[model samples]
Target: MSDYLVRALAFEGSVRAFAVRTTDTVGEAQRRHGTWPTASAALGRSMTAAVMIGAMLKGEDKLTVKVEGNGPIGPMIIDSNAKGEVRGYVTNPQTHFDLNELGKLDVRRAVGTEGALTIVKDLGLRDFFTGQVPIVSGEIAEDFTYYFAASEQVPSSVGLGVLVNPDNTILAAGGFIIQLMPGTDDETITIIEEHLSKMEPVSKMIERGLTPEELLFEILGKENVQLLDTMPVGFECNCSKDRFGSAIISLGESEIRDMIAEDGGAEAHCHFCMEKYNYSVEELESFIDEINS
Candidate 1:
């Protein structure tokens, strides 16, 4: 099934929740980046959480999530907007290791226990917000939970999971974010915590083919959750040949001339989607003209 997200409220709007089924979305990233099992888990987990966070914004607002850990997989970058579009990549896609003590993907080993998770939000009109927190857990979900409490100052519970196939493909990937708005009573918090403690892993629930709404129902109780709206989610990259060409043109006429004289052409590669754009020598000359004009 195609990926999608659902928003909901519980306990008369004192608690807000978001859940998403991202199997296909994460599969696309695995295929495009050739990420190994461990690396796939790390990248998929981050993207899963970031997409849900994206749903919290409005209009043209967007955010970028950076996971910089001191492990073999290096850094991970995810970009998402309020519209449910997300794209991401890890520094080392081929990184992997044996399962951990819990028999799950060794994400903590691939993403070291030390470093930081940073969020940069671009609100329209040049308004931006930045939040950074030390990595409390190499597991992407726990790190985000800490980020909410320490950085954003919201009490939140985050559950993220990615199950990888033996051939390094994604089996399932999804997550949920539950938060308490200001003025939430203590009784509501205790009830939510009790439900979370008895829930299944988010990845397993997703693999069982639960829809986003069902995922929320399972976590927040069907009787308590008030379904809000659903939005489609996918792996989308906005890079194009024209966009890359514009970037090259901005390098000035002299730089364009040097490219034609030395290399005969230019090639631009996108890290997010692994797409390459090639410009012929003639194309290079036109860019120089465009720059001069």
Candidate 2:
């Protein structure tokens, strides 16, 4: 099925939750980045979580997530908006390792536990909102949970996972985020915690063909959940040739002259989508004239 996420409220708005199935979406990222099994797992997990978080915003608002770890994967960055668009890249995509003790991809090893997860939100304000928290578990989900609690002061539970195939492809990818709104009773918190503790890994569920709605039912109970809006999610990048052209012009006339004299042409590559835009010497000369005039 196509990648999509569902938003819901349970127990009459006492609980807010989001669940997503991102197998195809994350797979696209793996193919784009040519990420190894472990790096794919780490990047996929972060992207899945970022999409769910992006759903929390209003129109035109967006957020960027940065995972700066000391592991082999280096730093991972994801940008997402309320419209369900997301783009991300890892500093090192070729990193991978054998399974850990649980016989799963060694994401923790690929994403070291020695750094922070920072989130910058652009709420259409003069100053953007920024939050940062130390990585509690390089596992992605737990680290986001810690981020919400420590950085945003919201008590939350985050479960994110990604399964990689032996051929260095993505098998499954998905996640869920459940947050307790204020005024939740003590009894309700305990019950939700119990259910969360007994839940299966999110990626495994997606691999089994479970939808986002069913995933939330598994966590919040069918009788307790109040279904909200649903949104389609996918791997999207905003890069364009026109944008690259503007960038070339921004390099100034002298720089454009250097390109024309030395290389005959210039090529620009986008890190997020691996797309290349080529400009001939003629195009560079035009840009030089535009900048000079």
Cα-based lDDT at residue 262, candidate 1: 91
Error at 153, model 1, angstroms: 0.8
Query: How do the residues 1-293 of candidate 2 rate in per-residue lDDT, one tens digit apiece?
Result: 99899999998899999999988888999999999988898999999999999999999999999999889899999999998888899999999887899988899999998899999999999999999999877989889999999988889999998988878788888999999999999988988889888988888899999999999999889999999889999999999999999998988888888998899999999999999999998889888788778
Model 1, span 105-167: residue lDDT tens: 999999999999999999886678999999977999999999999998999999999999888
Q: Candidate 1 — which residues are off by over 4 angstroms?
A: none
Give candidate 1's error at residue 42 in angstroms: 0.4
Off by over 4 Å in 2: none
- Write out the backbone clash pairs for model 1: none
**Model 2 Cα shift for residue 48 (angstroms):** 0.6
Most accurate candidate by lDDT: 1
